[model samples]
Target: MTIKRVGILGAGKVGIVLAGLALKAGYEVRISGSGSVDKIDLTISTLVPGAIASENAEVVANSDIIILAIPLSRYKNIDPTLLKGKLVIDAMNYWWETDGIREEVLDPTLTSSEQVQNYFKDSTIVKTFNHMGYHNLQEEALPKGDPKRKALFVTGDNHAAVDEVTKFVDSMGFDQVVHYKLTDGIMTEPGSPLFGASLKYQELKQIIDNFDHTDFGRKISSTLN
Candidate 1:
């Protein structure tokens, strides 16, 4: 399926960069921010040409693919109903210290992406675009036919949705798009090479296979602390 239109929910660096790439990939793009329209317009124009800047509802209503490029902490503030039946891409990270919350305690019950999926139950949530930095996202993009291009790992419960996202990832210059079971996304967490470092498909597979599963919750809790 062609991703003809995309709505980016945030006007920050990550959001604008993704929007620009989506536009380059021939998708009609719109961006929304909590900031004023004038400020958003300037930011969008600087980052992405021929893109529209509008209120959140307008962006949501106009686009087929919706990208949540905000912080993980902001998920609670979003109304999931607004994204029902859309392809929602989660590209957020949990920054405990910057969020002014305790760093050592994670809710052992869920990873950040899983929590985002839970919050947006009606939408098809696909975890992607979180593993790389904004600069790398733009600078490291490879041509579609390149043999050494990077791989993008995506996970979601819905097979059809994952396929759609995989195609989008391919269009964005990744030579390989790896699909994993929803629960397997933890393999791509912060400390993992898949988080920010480039790795071949086989290397990524080894990382996943070698991941320690013992007391996973406690392990995550310790990391948070």
Candidate 2:
């Protein structure tokens, strides 16, 4: 689907940073929090100047693409029906220190995005915007053609959806790496050398190659087995 408007499902740091990127990229942006507009308006105004503040349902219903920047624990609050057939970006990470570890997150058989995709059912769930810290997002992005431009990876089960998000990422000033499936996205999770490091294309690929021959691959192999 052609994505004209973007809806961000959290009003926190990550949500606002992404909203700023989308706004800078010329997309109609709407951001929501658990509270009413009156509660989130100031945050959005100060952080993501052009973004509109709305309730979760309204943001989800009106946008062409939805971004889930809320904590993974709050996934249930998002109505699957509203996300049906939409391109949804899963920008959440499971932090044991904050979001108590859960069985699903630790399940060897499932990638984090896979679990999130299961919940969103028919939505095209693309895993992205999760690896880096929110503070590093805006300033770290180098223009697309810069030789030392940082690269971001995009992974999802749907090729079309992944391609769409790659375009968005490109517009946001990062080079895009496309993984064949959601499971491959684990390379971008915490602990991997590429997780938050601002590396150019070649350096990022080398790290992935190195990671594969080490203990990281053994753990992943066991999980996928």
Candidate 3:
């Protein structure tokens, strides 16, 4: 499916950067903060030129793809009915200091994205845009043919949704690496070796290939869990 409009649900660091990139790529973007539109209007216009500052519902209703950049704890605040049949990108990370400790993510039975999928069952959920730090996002996005282009990993249960998000990622100037399933995405979440790392395609692939055999992956897994 073609994605011309993007709706970002949080106007924080992640949301701001994503909106700016999308707008720069010529996609119509609307970003909403938890507060009223008036509160976010100036910030959206100033930070993300050509992007509209809207309410959450308006943003959700007007776009082809919706990005969840809000805190994981605020997932329940989103209306599933509004998101039904939409492609939703889960860009949230579980931080114990802020989100508090939760057994759902710690249970080992579900990856963080899986938990998000359960909450937004009607929406097509893809796990991405969470591993890299906001500071690296704009600086690291290189053109398609650039030898130094970095790759972003995308994982989801739906192949179509994953493919769609992958194209979107590439359009914003990063290579897209598609993993087959949501379970495989745990390797890219916070604390993993790839998390917050800014690496080129080959370097990132090396980390992913050695993720299981290396002590680095196991150490990060144990530390986060």
Candidate 4:
């Protein structure tokens, strides 16, 4: 399925950057923020020219793909029913300091994307675009044919949804898009070698194949804390 209209759930750095990239990739883009759309219009204009800014419900209803770019802590405030039948991309990371929580709420049981999928039960959720820094996301993407093209990892239970997101990622100048199983998301966790680190597709696959749960446990404990 082709993704034409893309919606972003926040007006923060991630949201703005994604919106700009989506627009650059020839998709109609819309964005919503907690504050008035007017307040963020200047930022949106400066970042993504011709992007539509509106209320959350309007943005969610009008787009084929919706991106949740807000903090994981604020997820509770969103109503999943609003995103029913839509492709939702989870781009959030658990920030304990910002959320004022000592431990990750989804730790020891589910990865952040899985937890987000559970929370947004009605939406087809895909875990992606969370591993890279905002700056890297905007500046590092290279076209598909480029020798040094960057890669992004995506995980989801739905094959169609994964395919759609893969196309979207590729259109944004990602050289390679690795579509892994939902369980593989744990390997791309915030502190893993796959996260925030630039690596080739084969190298990333090797890292995932040889991943050790005990080593992951230590990384999770150290990074999440």
Quick one: best lDDT, which candidate? 3
What are the runs in model 1 whose C-alpha is more than 4 Å off? 102-106, 212-222
Which candidate do you rate higher for lDDT, 2 or 3? Answer: 3
Query: In model 3, which range of ten residues has the least summed lDDT?
Result: 212-221
lDDT for predicted candidate 2 compared with the true structure:
0.80
lDDT, candidates in the order shown: 0.75, 0.80, 0.85, 0.79
What ranking of all candidate models by TM-score puts the best one first?
3, 2, 4, 1
Query: TM-score for all predictions?
Result: 0.88, 0.90, 0.92, 0.90
Candidate 4, position 79, lDDT: 85
1 or 3: which has the higher lDDT? Answer: 3
**How many residue-pair clashes does candidate 1 contain?**
2
lDDT of 2 by residue, 42-139 (tens): 98988788899999888988998999999877787777897888899899876666567556444556767788888889888998878777767877
**lDDT for position 22 in model 2:** 89
Q: Model 1 residue 5 lDDT? A: 87
Model 3: per-residue Cα lDDT over 1-225, one tens digit each: 899999999999999999989988889999999999999999988888799999988998899999999988778888778799899999998877767776543455566777788878899899889899998997788789899888888888999989999999999989877776776677887777688998887787777778746645445556667
- Residue-wise C-alpha lDDT for candidate 4, range 86-144, written one tens digit per residue: 88988887766666663545555566777788888988888788877788888877777
Best by TM-score: 3
Model 4 residue 12 distance off true place after TM-score fit, in angstroms: 1.2
How well does candidate 3 match the true structure in TM-score terms? 0.92
Please list the Cα RMSD from the true structure of every candidate, rounded to 1 decimal place.
2.6, 2.5, 2.2, 2.4
State the lDDT at 13 in candidate 4: 88
**Residue pairs in candidate 3 whose N, alpha carbon or C atoms collide under 3 angstroms:** none
Q: lDDT for model 4, on a 0 to 1 scale? A: 0.79
